[model samples]
Every structure is written in structure tokens, then in C-alpha cells.
Target: MQGGVMRRRLRRRFGLGCLLVGIALVVAQSAAAEPRRLEVELSQLFDRLDSGFSNWQGQRLEFQSARPGDPTWYGAATHDRRYGVEDEGVSLGAAVPLGADWVLQPEAGHTFDADFLPRWYADLRLQRRLSHGLVGALSLRRTEYQASRVDRLALGMERYWGPWRAGYTLNVSDVSTAGTPVGHALALDHYYGERSVIGLRASLGREEEGLPGGEAITSEVTAVALRGRHWWHPEWALSWELGTLSQGDLYDRHGVQLGIRHAF
Candidate 1:
């Protein structure tokens, strides 16, 4: 009887030890299997850029719309007319962790029009975290217009402060006829919540004349946009935006856009 009791006790002790070892192994494996968190977003914008032409100085104003074969000018005698121009663009973007305190994002976008003009853009940015809820980013972007075969490069710095973000971009454009023209842009964006955002962006740029003998023309653009997203499931979402664009002295453009996204 004594020998049997001793054997039973030894068996119980060995069983408990095995269970503990199993639990420890599981905990270690789970820690090793955990994945780092990363965030990515893809967005599209359907908008219009209206160029309101007004008589300023002695220049004969010709207002051209994006629509194909539209009259270049309603009449030189008329000073007030509306030009309706629109563009549809889609962007694919991804953000990933590079290391501690650093992140990198790369994005590409393409725009198509009914008039056989297409635009393509590529951007790469690197961000570093700073103290006091601040972050800084350095970005490089390239844009190409397929119809005209013109290309532009932009270098910029972005700053984040609390819920507000701002950036300045410098652009150098190469035209087939005019050597190169430099432009500058400044933009501001504000976030109201985790999923709601508003942005006010403006850019002042110059474009060389399409014709051989035309001189460089200055262009200015201002835009205000509001965007929001709602998650229906863990991997699915709906997003929407409303925005307005003003180009030079031509016209004001208003647009609304919606999209649905799913993640695998």
C-alpha cells in the first residue's frame, strides 16, 4: 500500500510539470507569431478644375474646357461665361514600417479623360516621428501627361502638428517646346476624427504655351475638399468626398465622389 501511494504522488507531480511546460511553450510561440501593425489606404477622386477667364489687361481671353471639340471661346465680345471641365482619378497607396520611429509610403495615381488626355503620377515618402505629437516627411513625386508627353518632378516636405498637417512642394516641369519652368505649391489639411478629414489646398504654377511661339502662362489653383469613411466590417469600408476646384480666373468646379473598398 505505501509503495502504491508513493507512485501515485510521483505521477501527479510529473503530470503537473508537463502541463506547466506545455503552457510556457505556447506562450513563447504566440509571442513569436504576432505580426506588426501596418496601415494602408487606396482612394479615388472624381473632380473638376474650372478655369474662370476674366478680362485682365489687354490680353484677348480664350476659355477652353476639357470637353473635346468645344469652342475655345464663346465670343471675344463676351466677358462672362462658364467653362465646365472635369477629371477622374484613382490612386493606389501603401504604407509600411521600415524600422523603429520610421515609416515609408509609396503611391501611384492615374487620371483619364474623354478627350484622350491621360495623366500619371508617382510618389514616395519617408516619415520620421518627432516628440510632442509632431512628425516630418520628405517626399518625391513625378507626374506625366501622356497626350503632350510632358513630365514634371516635385520635391517637398510635410509637417504634422496635432490634427493639422501642412506641406510645401516645388515643381519643375519639362515641356517639349519650352525648356523648363519651376512652380511652387502649398497645402493644408485638417482632421476632425479618426475617419473624417478636410483639406484646403492651393497651388501656383506656370505652364508653357502649347504652340511654338506662345509664351509661358501662369496658373493658380485652389481647392477645398471634405472626406469621410465608414467601416461596415473589419475588412470593408465606404468612403466619400465632396470638393471644389478653382483654376486661374476661369470658373469654379464642384464634384462629388464615392467608393467602396474591401481588404483581403
Candidate 2:
């Protein structure tokens, strides 16, 4: 009986994740055609996954504001319910531009549950556009977990071909929990005029989870995601994202995110 329930949850999560990702990508691509100075986005996420202990269902609400060449801010509230426990959390983050091509993003948040811990993260990125329709970025990130801290470095490159673009990113991380891990991601997107876009992305990485007694479990993480964006008007757009996360055969999750945005 328990196995049946788990399977059902997994299927639902996968479907929802796909739907959400698809819509988000569509809207984002569409909105990029006529860029706005001030943008507001609201999103909802439905997720199901295992986190070492039990399977949980998460409902998250998020709000974001972005200004091109300036700063972007986001906040989110999440509720997770499982068989044995319920958890809630609120998170906020900001990405601020340091120059024409540098951005610093810092995020901190606290979760309410048995753990009741605060998490902190920060990332610094430098990006530049080349003369030949190419762009590149380098970034470093630090994340503080309850029992461990991790640092990651990434390099990314992108090429633009008319209305289609492709990007690749390579990442490496060092940590006590996950040991040394490496990953990479690829993305491709095509624009249909200035009103719509479709994109696909995939990533494979290694991550560590902290366990009791100062121990950690290392796992391989993989995901494939799709998203799309469409604009109904110059001022309004819709987007969706769908993705599946897998950690070998032991753990799997699917999520869907839906978003709507308006520009001032």
C-alpha cells in the first residue's frame, strides 16, 4: 500500500513539474522581445520529493522583481507536508549589479520545522557579451548548510544564431559533505518573432546531504527541464517550467512551476 501511494505521488509530481516548466519558459521567451525597465512576476510551484527521511508535498509561492542592468529581488514562502512532520519557510534574495557585467547575489532564509535552521547563500558572477554574438560568464557561489558549507565555481558560454541560442555551463564544487563534485548544464532556446520562445535544458551534478552524527551522503543528481514563454501584450506575459530531479533510483521528484509577469 505504501509503495502504491509513493508511486502515485511520483507520477503526479512529474506531470506538474513538466507543466509548470513549460509555461514559464514560454512566457519568459515572449517577454524578452520587448524588454521592460521594471518587471513583476508571481509564481507557484508544486513539488514532491524525498529528503532522506520521508516523502513530502510542497506548495510554494514566490514573488520577483527585476530591472535590467540594475538589480533583481525575489522572495518565496513554502509549505511542506509529510507523513510525520510539516515544514514551512520563507526566503528572500537579491541580485545586484556591480558594474556593466558583474552581479552579486546574496540570499538568506529560515525554515520552520524540527530542524528550524537558517540557510545562507551568496553568488558572484561576471558576464560579458562578445562582438560576435557570443556571451560568457564566470561565477563563484558559497552556501552554508546546517552542518556543512560548500563552494562552487562555474564557467558558462553562449552563442547566438539568429533567433536561436545555445548555452553551456560547467561547474565544480568542494565540500565536506559531498566531497568534490562536478557538473554541467546545457540549454537551447529559439525565439518565434518577438512574442514567444521555447527552450530545453538539462543538467547532471553531484550533491551531498548532511546526515546525523556529522556524516554525509553523496548522491548523483540529474535533471532535464523544459520551459516556454509567451506574451499576450507588451505589458503582460506568462511562463511555465517542468522538471524532474533524480538521485539514482533511491530518490526522485518532479515539479511544475507557473508564473505570470507584468511590466511597468
Candidate 3:
């Protein structure tokens, strides 16, 4: 990863991990409690950042507590070192019901002594359950760097039918220096026994790039991944991903991530 693209790739990795967790939890049956309102998860990822910059890696710990059909509080703390610079960040957020089958999620985060990652970040999303197992959502995100800013908007749809879920999303991003670029993502997941799931996701899109010397450009990027989760015990679950990404001809990379989640 190089310069600005590094942040974008990092964001994608985190997003992919969260995606698997979210989808899995939606169908998970804890067997400990009716809802298992309180939960904690620990995860790590290893990536081989090419081009001799540095290897990218991180560990994350997150917690959430909430009851069904009620307001939820969640937070995360992360320690990451990429490009040979170490940074730590924390974020707090909530999921609140807005009536009429609508839901809202808002979060804010800040990185301490940041060099590669954004110094400040915020996101807001609104979603509603539609007819016949369909849901629609819209989201906006902002990331502030030392001397740059990026804003993104996304529209998404998800459908669940007979042990299968499918989703699609379109994202448009605007960089202060680089131009706006659009990306599309699609996913499919199948569930068995309420706690085990397997999924595949693919994304292809254009990304805004600001090179080392204030050179702004747009680049094509594509990624594909297989992710899954299974419950080994009533209160414990395991999740994993294997993925590859390519950005034009700059670099080709493969990575793996694993996580464990528990309810208390």
C-alpha cells in the first residue's frame, strides 16, 4: 500500500470484517440468553503490504450491550502499526430504534498521534425494514486527515429469504484533492442451524488517489473474499476470512483474519 491508498485499503479490511460479524450476529442463536445483549470480541489481522513500505497489522477489541428492540451502546479500541508508525484509536457508537421499522447508527472516532490513519472519523447510517424480508439503508461518512478530508455516501439493500441473504451496495466518495469515485459491492450468504454461516463478497470500483508528490489520480481496484462463522459452544463463536485484493498493477496481496466472540 502507498500513501493515500493505504488508508483506503485499511478501511476496506475493517469494513469486511465488520460485515461478517454483522451478518452472522443477525442470525446467531446464542442459547445463553434470549438475546445475549452483552458481548465482547477480540480479533487480529495480518497483511503483507507490498512495495517495501511496511507490513500492516492490527488487533482490535470491541464490546456491545443492548436488548432487542432497544437502544444499544457499543465501542471499540484498536492498536495498529503500518508504514512503521504505531497508532491507537477508540470509537463510541450506538444503534437506536427510530420506530416504523427504522434504525439509526452513529459513531465518532479519533486517532491519537496519527501518521497514516485519519485523525478523526464519523459515520451515520439510517436503515429501514421494507416489505418481504428486504431492508434499505443510506449512510454518510467523513474522515479527516492532517491536511486532507474524505467524505463518502452509500446506498444499500439487503434481502433475506429461506436461509439465504443477499446484499448490494453502491458507494460514492469525494476526496478534497482527488476526484470523486464510485464503487459497487455484492454479497451472498447462507445459514445453517442458526449459528453457522458462509459468505462470499466481491467488490469492483474506482478509488481516489493522491500520490506522494501531490499527484492526484483515480485508480481501479477489485477484491474478493470468503468469510464464515460457526458456533463451537452456546456462548462462544469463531469467525474468519481469506481475501485477495488488487489495485491496478500496483500490487497483489493476500491476507487472513480470525476472531472470537463471546456473550456474557
- Using TM-score as the measure, the top candidate is 3
> Candidate 2 at 219: error in angstroms?
1.0
Worst 10 residues of 2 by lDDT: 1-10
Task: Write model 2 residue lDDT over 71-158, tens digit each, in one string.
Answer: 5566666665544455566667655555544445455555544232225456655555554666666778775556777788989877
**TM-score, candidate number 2:** 0.68
lDDT tens digits, residue span 79-139, model 1: 1111233334444544444544555656565555412223655766566655544455566
Superposed model 1: Cα runs more than 4 Å off: 1-96, 104-122, 130-132, 147-151, 161-166, 177-218, 232-236, 249-251, 262-264
What C-alpha lDDT do the candidate models reach, one value each? 0.39, 0.55, 0.66
Assess every candidate by TM-score: 0.49, 0.68, 0.83
* Model 1 root mean square deviation, Cα atoms: 22.6
Per-residue lDDT of candidate 3, residues 95-146 (tens digit):
6767647768787888786666678789887877777778787989987776
Ranking of models by TM-score: 3, 2, 1
By TM-score, how accurate is candidate 1? Answer: 0.49
Steric collisions counted per model: 7, 25, 0
| Residue 12 in candidate 2, Cα distance off native in Å | 17
TM-score of 3: 0.83
Q: Give the distance in Å from residue 21's predicted Cα in candidate 1 to where it truly belongs.
A: 42
> Model 2 segments beyond 4 Å from truth?
1-36, 48-56, 59-118, 193-195, 209-216
Which wins on lDDT, candidate 1 or candidate 3? 3
Candidates 1 and 2, the one with greater TM-score = 2
